[model samples]
Structure formats: structure tokens, C-alpha cells
Target: MKLNTDASVGEEGWIDLGVVACDSAGRVAFSAARRVRAFWPPEVAECKAIHMAVRLAKAQGLANVIIESDSQVVTTRLTTAALYFSDLDTILGDILEICNGFNPISFTHVKRDGNTAAHNLARAVPFGVEQCWENHVPRDVAPYVLMDTLSLD
Candidate 1:
């Protein structure tokens, strides 16, 4: 599956965060993003992405899944619950509940440059496409997406 996150800032400095999920074949499965009424907080945005990813996975009845993200904090929180969720406890609580449904799910940190597909999708949200796909990514990003899967025998 494919998982991605993004942030959008308004004139007032509030930032919207989002996360989207896709299946193995690059089909958009689910997505979630919201504009925070307050100030921009990268940590909160990161958590929002993780929360959406796990929630989508659970909704799709996926098991033994691998979730990918460009944010280290989000990845760490998914794997180890590293951050305290005081103010975001409600949201974090929901994410943790979804995590309980899977057997072998995991979170992996990918370089931001390596996560272009999701980033592109996130940017498209403003245009009303919460998720996007193709038979393949454009030539420019194909290499990055396939890099992890390519190996020399």
C-alpha cells in the first residue's frame, strides 16, 4: 500500500494536514486531512498523517501491512508511541485503536524526496483530488518509487 502526508498553510498561519492510503496496485483506498484552526505545528501535522494511515488500513481490513512516511516523528510514534499525546490524546487514541486490528503492520521512514507520489497527491487535494494515481507515476518519479524494490541478484 501507499501512504502519504502533507501540510498547507493559510495566511493566518494555520496549517492543514493530510494523509492518504492506496493499495498495492496504486488504487486510492482512503484519505483524511484537516485544517487546524490554530497555529502551525509540524508535530501535530505528522501525527495526523499517521493517524489517517492506520485508520485507513484498519478500515480496509488490511493485515501485515507496511506503512511509509517521510516524517520521523510520525514513524517513531507509530512504532514506539514515542510522543506524549496530551492535547492530541483523542486523536492518538483513535490511531492506537486502529493499530490494534493488525497483525504485522509496521511504519518505515522514507526520505521526503523519496515520497514524491504521496506528496504530489497531497498537493492535489486543494484541487479536490484527495487521492490520485495512474498505471505508473510520471517518468521523473518512477525511479524513486521503484528504488526500494529494485535489487541486483
Candidate 2:
């Protein structure tokens, strides 16, 4: 499974996080979203989204996954082994710790346009609410998921 993650920060300082996990055929395995009031930077928010994605994936019994995000910094940090001094160290460590149980897990950085489903979910969910769906996504995200499925054809 491949999980696409994204984050949208509202002007009021609330960060909305989204995660959409799909199989190779672009079928939704599960989708999740949450809104939190945090003033973290974009990269930090993106990292948090991935962390949330991994946690949800595990909770859903997804044993293998590739966590994809638009933040190059987070993906690069997770993909590379070199240690860096920054705010991400703890978050990265937490993510890596969670990966021990999975057989093979990876992280990738994709363009924002390619990750519209997750991007939409991040913006669509209301503040102070968290939601998750299995086997399908809500109406707002279904179109994007359908577009992605068609693209694979």
C-alpha cells in the first residue's frame, strides 16, 4: 500500500492533516483526517501528518506501506540515513521506531498536484475533528481518487 499525506494550515493557526492509503490499483484502503491547532512550520506539520499516517496505517492492519508526502524535507530526512540537527530528529525517530514491525516501509516525496486526494482531505475536514474511512473516501475526495485510478489505466 502507498499512503499519501498532506497538510493545510488555516489562517487562524489550525493545521489540518490528511492521509489516504491506496493499493497499487488506486483503490482506497483507508483515509484519515484531523485538525489541530498548532503553529508549527510547514515541514513540521508535514512530518506530523506522516507520523499520523503511519500510526493509522498500523491501526488499520496495514503491514507494509510507502508514506508519500509533498514535503521534500521530511521525505528526504526519512529516506536518508544521515543524522541532521533540527526539530525533525525526534519526529523522525518516532516514525522509524514504528517501522520496525513492518516488513518493508519507505517514504517518498511527490508533487502537490499528484497528491490532490490527500490535499483535499486536509482542507475538507472541519477543525477539532478527526475522521477515518475504510474501503472508500468521502464525496469530496472520491473524485480525486477516481482521477488517480483513471491515470493508472
Candidate 3:
């Protein structure tokens, strides 16, 4: 499967954003885009990204999924569930609910350099936009996308 994913955050403030895709066999079958608003905290954003990924995997009918992220907090939370989620309990709850729909899901932490595509997309998220990928992302995010794709190798 060739799952290509990317994300970016705007320069306005501290925002968490991400994108994930699932390929069935050799085809790009499912994709997810997310951009947490300014109100949503980082932890919430992180969990939402994972939730989106898992949901996409389930939607694609994948039994096993290899999820990737640059945020150590998100990775640790998903893997060990040891982090304190006081601020994001609701978001975490939502993520856990989505997780129940998947058969098996895994999380991996990659360096920011490796997760450039998603980071770039997160940065591009507009101020008022919540989460969606209906329009074309900025071309300036290409370099990061390339970097992200290469890192997967």
C-alpha cells in the first residue's frame, strides 16, 4: 500500500495539525485531514490526529495499521496511556472510542524532520478552520511533503 500523508500548522499560534492516509494493497483507498482550532490544546490535537488515522484505517477496512507521528506526547499516550490527559480527557475519550472500531492499531514516533509533511500541513491550517481537506493545500508545503515521503523510506 502507498499511503501518503502530510500536515501543517499556521504561524498564528501554537496549533497541532496532521494528515493520514491508508492504501489498500497498492491503491490509495482512504485519506484523513485534520486541523485543530486555536481553542483545542496540543494534547487534544495530538489525540485527534491519531483518532483520525485510526478512523481512516477502519474506514479502509485495514486490520493492521502502522501510525506515525512527530509528537512524542501523542506516541506515548497511545502506546502506554501513561500521560496525564487532564486537559484533553474529552478528546482522549473520543480517540479511545474511535480506537475501539479498529482491529489493531500501532503508533510510532518520528523526528520532526521526518514528519515534515504533516507539520507543514498543520502550519497551513487557517485561523478559523477547524479540520478539513476539501481544498488544495498551498504549494509552498511541497518541500515538506517531499521530505515526509522520503523519510518514510
Candidate 4:
């Protein structure tokens, strides 16, 4: 399984977050987006997105997953067991706890260009609401998902 996550912080301090999980064949297993009130730094938002994605995967009964993010800092932190001092420590701790629920998980960093589906979902999120899809793609994100699938070629 592969999960891609992204977040966008609005000027008003609202955060729009998105995550999409795909199977080995690149078909979506789950996808979600929400506008959250806790507005944090971009990296923090990115980490939050990852956290939510992992929760979704666990809920879907996935055993192992590769979590990918455009934020290199977050992925790098997840790569090591070493802890660093940061305002995001709590979130990082939660991530570590969540990963333990899975058999084994890996984290990787990708360029923003490589994460179009999640990015588009994040950008398209509605304020104060959440949208979720299971075993299917949302209508608004269908184009982005198609683009993402094409890029896999």
C-alpha cells in the first residue's frame, strides 16, 4: 500500500488537509480531505496530514504501508528513531505510536510535483467540512487521480 498526504494553510489560519491511499495496482483504497481549525506551520500541517492518513489506513485494516509526503523534514524525522526537539514533538510521538499498530511501515519524501492527487485534494477542500471516499475516488479529485495514474507509466 502507498499513502500520499498533503496540507494547505490558508491566510486565515485554517488548514486544508488531504490524504490518499492506493493499493499495489495504484487503485485508491481510501481518500479523505478536511478543513481543520488548528492552524499550524506548514510542516506541522504536513505532519498532521500524515497522522490522519495513518489512522485511515489502520481503520481500513491495512497491515503495512509506505507513507509519502512532500515535506522532507517530516519524512526525515520519521526515518530515524531519534527524537528531536520541536513544537511538533507531540504529533511526532503520536505518529510513532500509530506506526506500532501496523506490522511495519516506511516513510519517504517526494517532490510536490509527484504528489498531485493529494495536493489537489488539499487545495479543493471545503472549509469546516470533511469528505471521505473508500474503494472509490471523489468526483472532484477524479481528474487529479487520473493524472496521477498516468504519471505512474
Candidate 5:
């Protein structure tokens, strides 16, 4: 499975996080959009998005997955297993722990343009709500998902 994730911060300091997982054929496996209270920086929000992706994959019984994010800092930290000295340390640790549940998992950084599906999903999510789609595409994110499938083809 390939999971693309992204996060956006609203003007009022709320964070919208999204994760979209697709199979080799580009079929949507799982997708989630969540609103989280703001306290940390954008990098932390990115980490949250990725952590959610790992959890979703595990819940769906996927043993191997490649998690992609548009945030280079978050991806680099996770991929290198670097020890962060700040509040991110805890979130990073949690991400690493989540990875342990999978037989094989990898993290990669991607350009924001390449992560449009997750971007749109994150942007569309209303604050204070957590919505998820499993085994099918949500109507609001369908166009973006189609674009992803086209690009993969």
C-alpha cells in the first residue's frame, strides 16, 4: 500500500490532517480527515498526519506500506530515526512505535503537488470533526482521488 498524507493549519490555529491510502492499482483502501486543536507547529501537524496513516494501515491489516508526506522535515526525521530535542520528540517516538506494528514500512518526502489528494482532503475537512472513509471514496474527495489514480497509471 502507498499512503499519502498532508496537514493544513487554519487561521484560527486549528490543524486539519488527512491520510489517503491506495493499493498498487490506485484503489482507495482507507482515507481519513481529522481536525485537531492547535498547540504545536506545522511540523507537528505533519507528523500527526503520518502517524494517523500508520494507524489506519495497521487497522486495515496491511503489513507493508510506504507513507508519503509533503513535509520534508517530518519525513526526514522519521526516516532517519533522528532524536528530536523538542516537543516533537514525543510525537516522533509515537510514530516510530506505530511503525513497529507493521512488518515493513517506509517514509518518503514528496512535493506538495504530488500529494494533492491528501491536500484537498485536509483542506475540505471542517474544524472539530473527524471523518473517515474506508473501502470507498468519499464524494468530496473523489475528483482528487481520480487524479491520483490517473497519475499512477
Candidate 6:
């Protein structure tokens, strides 16, 4: 599975985390959006998105996945030996722990332009509830999914 995650801040200053997983065929395997009320930086929010992504993958019984995030800082940190001390340390630690469940997993960085599906999903308003879509994505994200499919052509 190719899992992509992103984070957006709503007008209410709520952090919205979005995660989307697709099969090799570009079909959505699972997607999720969550709204969090916190005063975290964008990088922190991105880490939370990744955290949620890995946890959700475990919940869905996925044994392996290539996780992607738009935040270069976070992904770079995850792939490097040097851990910068900050709020992200704990969250990154937890993410790495959950990542152990998979036989092999990877964290990659994608440009914002290439991750529109998760980008738009992060802007979604789930009203303090974490919304999830299985076997498909919400309507708002379908166009981006199609865009992704076309790009892979």
C-alpha cells in the first residue's frame, strides 16, 4: 500500500490530519481525516498525521506499507539517525514503535503538488470526529484520486 498523509489548519485553528492509502492499481484502500484542537506547529501536525496513518494501517491489518508525507522535515528526520529534540521526538518515537508491526515499511517525502488527495482531505471538516472511508475515498477527494491515477499512467 502507498499511504500518503497531510495536515491542514482550519479556520478555527483546528489541526486536520488526513491519511490516504492506495493499492498499486491506484485504488483507494483506506482513507481517514481527523480534526485536532491543538496549538502545534505545522511540522508537528504533519507528524501527527503520520502517527495516525501508521496506527490506522495497523488497525486495518496492513503488514507493509510505504508511508508518504508532504513534510520534508518530518520524513527526513524519520529516515535519519539524528533526532532533533522537540515536541516531535515523542510522536516520532511512537510512530516508529508502531512501524515495527510491519515486515518492512518506509517513510518518504512527497511534494505538496504530488499529494493533492491527502492535502484536500486534510482540509475536510469532520466536526471533531475522525471520518474514515474504506475501499474508497470521500467525494471531495475523488478528483485528486483520479488525478493520481492519471499521473501514474
Question: Each candidate's lDDT (Cα)?
Answer: 0.59, 0.88, 0.56, 0.86, 0.87, 0.88
Off by over 4 Å in 6: none
Give the per-residue lDDT digits (tens) of candidate 5, residues 1-153.
999999988777889998989998989888899988787688889988888888878888899899999999889888899975788878999989978988788899989888989998887677678788887657888888888889876
Q: Backbone collision count in every prediction?
A: 0, 0, 12, 0, 0, 0
Local accuracy of candidate 3 as per-residue lDDT tens digits, 1-153: 332333443455445555635343322344345554455555556666666666655665666566777767767776775545486666656666766765576667877676665566655655545454422334665565545455546
For model 4, state the Cα shift of residue 67 in Å: 0.6
Candidate 6, residues 37-146, lDDT tens digits: the string is 88888888999999999999999999979989989989988877346677789898888889889878888998998899998987776677788889888897899988
Candidate 4, poorest ten consecutive residues by summed lDDT: 81-90
Q: Give model 1 RMSD, 1 decimal.
A: 4.5
lDDT of 2 by residue, 29-65 (tens): 9999999998988988998899999998888888889
Question: Model 5 — which ten-residue stretch has the worst lDDT?
Answer: 123-132
Error of 5 at 100 (Å): 0.5
Q: Candidate 1: where is the Cα deviation over 4 Å?
A: 8-40, 83-85, 88-90, 127-153
lDDT of 1 by residue, 16-50 (tens): 55555555655455555455455636656666667
Model 5: how far residue 3 lies from native, Å: 0.9
Query: Please, what are the lDDT tens digits per residue for candidate 4 over residues 70-145?
Result: 9998999888855778788789889989889887799999999888889888866667787788887678788877
Give lDDT: candidate 2, residue 69.
Answer: 96
lDDT value, residue 15 of candidate 3:
56
The TM-score that candidate 2 achieves is 0.95
Better of 3 and 5 by lDDT: 5
